[model samples]
Target: MVAVIAGPDEMVGRSLPFSELSDCPYVVLLGEPGSGKSTVFETAAKAASRSVTIARALRVSGGQHVESPLFVDALDEDRSEGSKKDKIFQLRDKMLSSSLECWRISCRVEDWRGAADLSALQAATTGAPIVVTQLQNLSVREQAKILTSRGALDPEGFIGQARRHGAASFLECPSSDKMGVLT
Candidate 1:
């Protein structure tokens, strides 16, 4: 179906519509910076009816006024430096709480603390079968470069491993995915 979405100037420019999300239990969007997380909500909101309520994470922290399903931009600049871990746990708790019908969160994989937070979020969400999407960066080459620089990846070794496994490599690639911190 062809979906209609309102532009940025509209009231629903960056929030999802209630009808579009009523069936979804909860979702967590995972990716790096500038990965179009806001766009997803914006598109969903365009088709929604007017008067749907939405709020960001900062406002939620100050006073728990926003109702579910809440759309939280976890990568927003307003997040405090020292309170990231706490914020994540709070979000997790809120998302999983009985009061919330649904919730959505976005975070960058490159954020070291967020990386840890994702694991905890993943663990909690798994029981509820939440949808998770990894939005690939616009520049795949740059994405590879970031991984290499982080020492989380070794390009040469990856390519060599890929060659060894032939077409089946990705089926078992990024070996790190299977390795623990101590491994």
Candidate 2:
């Protein structure tokens, strides 16, 4: 059931059903790069209404406790992308062994999982090959929100980058209440 198909630099974003999104003990958000996966994580953090602890996948090593809801970004990627899978497995073991509220991890769609999927598909097609490309650009409102969040999060850097990138159009977008992030 294709509900909304996109045109041009757009895509039909998908996720686990809302029930699973809200109820799952752990969830992974996978997408093409710049597909607003970070925004989804932030929105989920807001909805969870718990102490949010975020860590980059590289920094997720060591004796991390389960004191609060944790969101680890880019679990399937790192400078040592291949070696990091061991760490991910270890983290999973740790999470299962610990008491926790909830947790999530995000990764690029072209990372390990996508690589494996593509490889299998290509082999099945007699090595004709397959390629994955960017799926969508942020909507006007989402762009504005991202701009605001970026500025708030990194005022100096965002100012320079926004000007250089000619992102002034993002300023014209209307704001959304966006209260349904959880739902």
Candidate 3:
């Protein structure tokens, strides 16, 4: 369905179908910058009526607030070349151990050189399921390349690992479904 952007001078835009959402519990939203990536996430959260904490993708340094069902907005600024994959791995470790139910992680495709490190990380960490959209710039092939170069042993093993981790990637009741009904 066509979705309207809520900003002051924003225009209407097309949207993905809810049914297209991943069947798995966790979701990672992958997309290029300015591809309405964040909007997609906000829309999903609004539709599900779930509360989401948006954060920049980075190591939990001093003041970064980590929340469940988190939307990692943008990581384009992260130029940690060799450490990039490692950082993602560490982040996944922390997330897996958290008590959050569902998480939607959005990262710019160009940031990781078109990699799905976020997805791999989520799979490793929480075993909670995740959904991802493509960043506008990179192609799926490029994303696959990045995932491979990073030494992700089981690229598509997120779902199984999530099951083993026992972390419910997504909240049973999406926030969209929780909106108060009108009388």
TM-scores for all candidates?
A: 0.45, 0.46, 0.46
- Count of backbone clashes, every candidate in sequence: 0, 0, 30
**Candidate 1 lDDT tens digits, 1-183:** 111122123322234322343465555555545445555555444443212223234335544544555666654443455555455555555555535555666555454253465566654443454544454322334334434666745655654554576732232222222232112
Per the 3 Å backbone cut-off, how many clashing residue pairs does candidate 2 have?
0
List clashing residue pairs in candidate 1: none
lDDT by residue for model 2 (1-183), tens: 011121112223441222234543444455555445555566667776743344343245466556445665665455244553445445555554555445666666556455443333232222222222222343444444555664556544544565588854333222122322211
The lDDT, on a scale of 0 to 1, for candidate 2 is 0.44
The CA lDDT of each predicted structure is 0.45, 0.44, 0.45
* Predicted candidate 1, C-alpha RMSD: 14.7
Give the C-alpha lDDT of model 1. Answer: 0.45
TM-score of 3: 0.46
Of 1 and 2, the candidate ahead on lDDT is 1
The runs of at least 3 residues in candidate 3 whose Cα sits more than 4 Å from the true structure, single-residue gaps closed, are 1-23, 57-67, 78-86, 113-131, 135-183
The list of candidate 2 runs beyond 4 A from truth reads: 1-20, 51-61, 79-85, 112-183
